[model samples]
Target: MIKNIMQKVMALACSFIFSTGLAFASTQTAVTAQLVKSEADGTVLICQYRTMKKIHFKVLFTHQVCPLAIQVGH
Candidate 1:
């Protein structure tokens, strides 16, 4: 009886840990991008992200029309 209870508890704990880790991982990589400008050349996107280092990530849509507006994080 005690062994079974312990096993159940451990399983629960492990699952909780895994779920939390996945959630954290997803949040860390998630970012929001805004259409800054659009020209005949291409469209520019300003991305917002949270991280330790400052990285300059630019998006340009040369052939496609600039995105009107977007609200997404992934």
Candidate 2:
């Protein structure tokens, strides 16, 4: 009947909304984590590619440094 059809349509709409919200939340969390990691690291590297119109940047943390480099003098 019409009632059954309405129920199915509502269910579909609710599910779609829920899924979209979840996707947005996950993306926000990932960006926050990346920012935190970059801050914990001291140095920042930036690179630009003119032909591709792209830019890349990274923050280097202390733990990421090579132990061998640190021990080079010792």
Candidate 3:
């Protein structure tokens, strides 16, 4: 029936809206980590960071070259 079809359409629309909101919300808390491994021995390394929002870097050393921790939007 037409009512049943309309109900299904409304449900689909609500689900889509809810999912899009979740996707945007997730991006706010999302963080990306990067690892840099140096093949040549060096004491100091040059690094550049790029992001949509403000970020801070926490450098962790496991070896000569280690992973970089990135914090977004804070």
Candidate 4:
């Protein structure tokens, strides 16, 4: 009767809601990783570093090897 039709409609409505929620839950966000800095020849490589994903800030760091270790005197 009408109850059967309403039952089906309710089921469909619930399924639609659930499916859309799942789609949003499974949404993919593209995160990019780029080489931020580097030294000549060979030294250090800085990268992703928490990637600023869901975070509001980025981290910066420097690495030196072999040469450039000495701080210039005043």
| Model 1 per-residue lDDT tens digits across residues 1-74 | 99999999999999999999876775536444555444443354443333233333335555544454454445
Q: Worst lDDT window (10 residues) for model 1?
A: 47-56
By lDDT: ranked, best first? 1, 3, 4, 2
lDDT of 3 by residue, 1-74 (tens): 99999999999999999999876774347655443332333545433344545433444333544345444452
**Candidate maximizing lDDT:** 1
Model 4 TM-score?
0.34
Where is model 2 more than 4 Å wrong at Cα? 26-74
TM-score of 2: 0.35
**Candidates by TM-score, descending order:** 1, 3, 2, 4
lDDT of 4 by residue, 1-74 (tens): 99999999999999999999766753353443333333343343333222333322232234532321212211
**Scored by Cα lDDT, where does model 4 land?**
0.45
lDDT of 2 by residue, 1-74 (tens): 99999999999999999999876674223221112112333453322112122223443544553221111110
